[model samples]
Target: MSYNKGWRYIAFLSGFVGLLGVTLYPIAISPMIDASEYKKIQKEARKNIRQEDIQPGNMKVWSDPFGRKKPDSE
Candidate 1:
């Protein structure tokens, strides 16, 4: 009975530790992984961006449909 109890306690402790590691692993590692990826994306975006793309002069003015003259109703 003592041997069985000891094994049971070891098994329970192992399972608890495993679950705690699994829960904390992502919390510890995700920010580091995400920060690196975010930096990589920022660099790529900056490299691919063109000066004209950011200029407001290239933008078209929005036309309002309500401001247009309606065709003469027959």
Candidate 2:
């Protein structure tokens, strides 16, 4: 009985540690590891984008597909 209890305790502790590591990795470790790489990739992506491409000039913000006509004054 004592041997079994000891093994059970070991298993429980191992599982608890594993769960803690998994839960904390994304919240803590991943940011530290990927922060620089992520910023570099974002910068490269932004370099290809232009202000004209992001502008919404002459484009309707929203349109009703149900054929509802908006007032001309609006």
Candidate 3:
């Protein structure tokens, strides 16, 4: 049995992409221990909470209407 040249090329490309993702995934999620921006933001948020400036009642619970399945009229 013979396979198309295009199929072989596609299979090779897919394998290459999968391998690339596996190799780079660790590097992607590896956090920068040097950055203090997250710490700063957390500190500011805590300060706001202590001041009661962040109102819970003012926040609206967001919902995705499209997330629920609708019954078919048919």
Candidate 4:
């Protein structure tokens, strides 16, 4: 079947190859390649502290300090 010139059969073929790589190559062939660059990012992420990692601020200075109800008369 002939496709319009603008619709790329080459692109479709390349996409099929990529899909085959992801599905078949990983299973039948050798393991997928991994770069060492992500190791640096993993190290940085491990250094960052979570919210509860440090002690919370003093509650006395909080916005709604006492949690008091507003007066009835508007």
**Residue 45: error of model 1 in Å?**
11
TM-score of each: 0.39, 0.44, 0.34, 0.32
Q: List ranges where model 4 is wrong by over 4 Å.
A: 1-7, 31-74
Q: Which tens-of-lDDT digit does each residue in 1-74 have in candidate 2?
A: 34547779899889999999999999999989879878988899899787565769765555676988767994
Winner on lDDT between 3 and 4 is 3
lDDT tens digits by residue: candidate 3, 1-74: 86648878799889999999889765664346444666788898887454344547765455576798777999
Better of 2 and 3 by TM-score: 2
By TM-score, highest first, what's the ranking? 2, 1, 3, 4
Give the Cα lDDT of each candidate. Answer: 0.79, 0.83, 0.70, 0.66
**How many Å off is the CA of 45 in candidate 3?**
24
Looking at model 2, the pairs that clash are none
Task: Tell me which residue pairs clash in candidate 4.
Answer: none
Alpha-carbon shift of residue 21 in model 2 (angstroms): 0.4
RMSD to truth, every model? 11.7, 8.4, 12.7, 12.9
Instruction: Please give the ranking of all candidate structures by lDDT, highest first, separated by commas.
Output: 2, 1, 3, 4
Output the TM-score of candidate 3: 0.34
Q: Supply candidate 4's per-residue lDDT for 65.
A: 64
Q: Candidate 4 lDDT, tens digit per residue, 9-74?
A: 778888889998889865656433553456777778878765354546633333676789888996
Which stretches in model 3 have alpha-carbon errors above 4 Å?
1-4, 30-74
